[model samples]
Target chain A: MSFIQRAVKVPPNSVSLEEARHRVFDFFRAACRSIPTIMEIYNLDDVVAPSHLRSVVASEIRKNSSVTNPKVIDMLLFKAMEELNNITEHAKQRHHIIGQYVVGHQGLVQDLGTKDQGASGFLKDFYKSNYF
Target chain B: MALRAALLRHVRIPAQTLNPALTLTGGKWGPPSLRWMSSHDDHLTKSEVTERVLSVVKSFPKVDPSTVTSDVHFQKDLGLDSLDNVEIVMALEEEFKLEIPDKEADKIDSTNLAIEYIYNHPMAG
Candidate 1:
């Protein structure tokens, strides 16, 4: 049996040039202003600096220059938000050593014993000092 | 020693015979203001970059400031892993207010390299 796939057509030039430019500028401005605060709060200052974030945003804007439709903008914004949330969630999970430890029997043995007793001891000491 | 003395003698002759026009200007072209402005922020010098980089490295809670030096390697000498290296590079990007490309950022594995990179970067302020 043969299957046929349908191609979807996208409308071009849906938004005015001026409107596109304004929206792009607004997006960048909002991103730059909030990125630093976000980095600080998330303890991401070490992993990604505000300048890096700005550069990434600028590149993303440049890449999507042809996108002017409001619906597309909303979709892109939603996608970006999802990506940021994922990064934040991943960072939060990775920030704690306990979260990195495996739960299954073999995984637990590998982490606590096979992986180096010194590191496990250090983790224990760190847990005691920081948590208790 | 002889070369040093000869250089000193040449310098003394110029100082003793200071240009009359320069003296008559009454310190109009004095270097003090130029030095002050240069230190204030017009440029990023090697020493300034070194000091700032050292301070940032020292600010890490796990790092001992006294152990930091220009010659120290981020991983080999400082015992920082790759993630810590990323953090340090990010901190440098923030301090210099410049976006270091990932390719270049990856190469900055030591305090000395960071100092050199910042000192040579034309856009660094």
Candidate 2:
């Protein structure tokens, strides 16, 4: 587990967007490197491959792609790093990992009943992942 | 060159006389004729490396398998984003069991580059 112990030091703020973009890629690589240990720790091999988890991490980063501010990107990256640390440390349970990442946002609640089939798109979108 | 040959003759005469004596003494040391091998000899061939590299690039979910070629760019030809590019490089690393440095990894944007990098890598087994 000593390998999992990363330097959690706070790097100085990026002076420009180019620097911030580099930091994001560095963080993304770090997260991808840890997927093997994360899979072993959470017993995710049965449901997900490393590539799928890699894409999931990328999608999570893409979710905040609209934010152009370097400071905001830094903050989001810090939060993402903290989440990755908690996950690699086994501070989370198997179902937590499954529900949050593997099963995806829509996999959590699927209304199989025909009664909701006639529901408006807005309601369905709201039920899916909060935002329309 | 003549002086060097004369020196070699003198050294070889002693070594020839000592070889049987050393072997008769049951010494652990062996003659200089023995050869040692290292993992360097277990290198992957260029064709095999290229084939595996292409397979890895084609397997990426967002890549159209048919559109993939040795010279196709991940972003321009395959239409993948930067993240997908990184993901593909990571997949190649996993396949070859080689940890490419970040600087070199960022440079591998196409199948040809990936194959060339992995093929030239001494420890890419």
Off by over 4 Å in 1: A1-34, A37-132, B1-41
The digit string of per-residue lDDT tens for model 2 on A98-126 reads: 88889888886687789888888888788
After TM-score superposition, the amount by which residue B98's alpha carbon in candidate 2 deviates from its true location, in angstroms, is 1.3
| lDDT by residue (tens digit), candidate 1, B25-88 | 3576665554554544567778888889899889865578889988999899888765457667
Residues A22-91 of candidate 1: C-alpha lDDT, one tens digit per residue: 4445444545555665666656655654555555556555666567577676556555544444443443
* Steric clash pairs (candidate 2): none
Q: What is the lDDT of candidate 2?
A: 0.85
Taking all chains together, each candidate's TM-score versus the true structure is 0.40, 0.79
Q: Across all candidates, what is each one's fraction of true contacts kept?
A: 0.00, 0.69
Model 2 misplacement above 4 A: A1-9, A118-132, B1-38
Candidate 1 scores an fnat of 0.00
- Specify the highest-TM-score model's number: 2
TM-score of 1: 0.40
TM-score of model number 2: 0.79
